[model samples]
Target: MDNETLQAWVEQVSRDSFGRPFLHQATFNRRLRSTGGRYFMRSHDIEINPKQLETFGREETEKIIKHELCHYHLHLTKRGYRHQDADFQRLLAEVGGSRYCSALPGQTKRVQPYRYKLVCRSCGMEYLRKRKVNPAKYACGKCRGKLFIKMLDFVLEP
Candidate 1:
């Protein structure tokens, strides 16, 4: 749950699974949202997503830690450490690590609404846009006429 316990667990997993000692630090990274864990190539440190533990519990989190450890051990030994590499894949399978982490519920990216619209005054052509743009910087493609921007109103229906 905490950093210290995570560090000890990572070291233990490294030794038990890979027969290699994990010398680097392992900490719970609160900022990690999309992935279960990350391995730093430069620092050789491992970061576990705390949300994974809270969501999936210890069993799934341990697999994520093993996944990171695969990268750690292979990279340090000058072996194939990337996801596509044969060595990494073999090691991962041998350790029974998870190939991909599951996405957290309600973590999907929000779709941006079309908040603005560009209108051609001459041709009455319109373009829906998600971001606001300067009307002076753009021209209407249909008639090469002047363009004006308007804010679109959203009406929520029951």
Candidate 2:
């Protein structure tokens, strides 16, 4: 979703879940990598990762919004807002918000390192491998066919 829709979503989520209004802006930052969302302390604006909705869909993104809102509302109310804070954790659990921003498997945006991949043409199976492999050295476990490798785009989620 674009920034406009993202703003509306954030507003709705704030009121519906927290019973509070989000006066600051909510935007989508394409350059945001690794984290699911960012809550700006200076501007009090919320920035969400666009790839999140495109990859994981609305359900996951909403959870992310709830996660960010925990920070926003808590910070505004002068409560413990940091991830390590007790109030933040309690509110997040009560609201059923995501504990952490989830990273897509095999995506380069992942904080966890991914070293390789293996694809089986015969069975059309794609695998995320943690270490590099020689293509011709091994065959598909299921059909004994050659394997191909690809670098992930770090776009959509599984």
Candidate 3:
């Protein structure tokens, strides 16, 4: 949806869920990554990730709107608005907002597997390492045995 519609929707949701009118701007932010929405403390403006709507549709997007509104309203009223604050938690639960802002599709960080392994020649103990390291510098924690480094050729599936 367009910014106008999003703005209207945010205002309506603010009124309906929080019983407070949203006076600040609400817009779709294309540059937002990982997070589904954001509430700017300085401007009191709310930015919704357009990718969220495209990926999850209106039902889930409404929850994200609620989440941002929780931050917006609490921050404006001089109450605790941060994620760790009790007031924010209470209001968010009352409004039925998403527990956490979900990452957009294909926006989650990928984990790289270990590229090397250190083996204890005397005790058969093994240690996985993310990067190449000299085995001569370290000894096995259990047996203090001599160690050898082995490069791994593991591939990660998408």
Candidate 4:
């Protein structure tokens, strides 16, 4: 949807859910990623991730609008607006807003296993590392000795 439609939707949601009018702008922000929406504290504007609508459709996108509204309303009223605040959490739960702003598809973070080890030449002390490191830049903590880096073979468990 366009900015005008988003603005009207946000206003309607605010009035229906929070019993308040949203005076600021609401727009589709193409740059938004990971999070479904964002509420600007300073401008009091709400930005929805356009990708959310494309992926999840209107029903889910409405929930995201509610989530951002919770932040907008709570912050404007000088109440607990942060996600950790009781007021924010209670309002969000009461309105049935999404717990999280829903991650975009294919945007989840990946975990990398340790593939290298730093071994102290003198003491044989070893430190597992996820990335390659220059041994010359670091010294062994136990004996302050020169360290050498070695690749480790990892076997996946069945």
lDDT of 1 by residue, 1-158 (tens): 67999899999999999998999899999999889999999999999999999998999999999999999999999999999999999999999999999889889876677888899999999988888899999999999999999887882221
Best by lDDT: 1
What is candidate 2's CA lDDT for residue 23? Answer: 97
Residue 73 miss distance in model 1 (angstroms): 0.5
**What lDDT score goes with residue 85 in model 1?**
100
Query: In the order shown, what is each candidate's alpha-carbon RMSD?
Result: 3.9, 10.7, 3.6, 4.1
Task: Give the 10-residue window scoring lowest on summed lDDT in candidate 4.
Answer: 149-158
Against the reference, the lDDT scores of all candidates come to 0.92, 0.86, 0.90, 0.89
Task: Tell me the tens digit of each residue's lDDT in model 2 across 47-138.
Answer: 88888888889999999999999999999999999999999999999998999877865666435555567888799677776667778888
Best by TM-score: 4
- Name the runs in model 1 displaced over 4 angstroms: 110-158
Candidate 4 has a TM-score of 0.77
- Ranking of all predicted structures according to lDDT, beginning with the best and ending with the worst: 1, 3, 4, 2
lDDT of 1: 0.92
Which of candidates 2 and 4 reaches a greater lDDT? 4
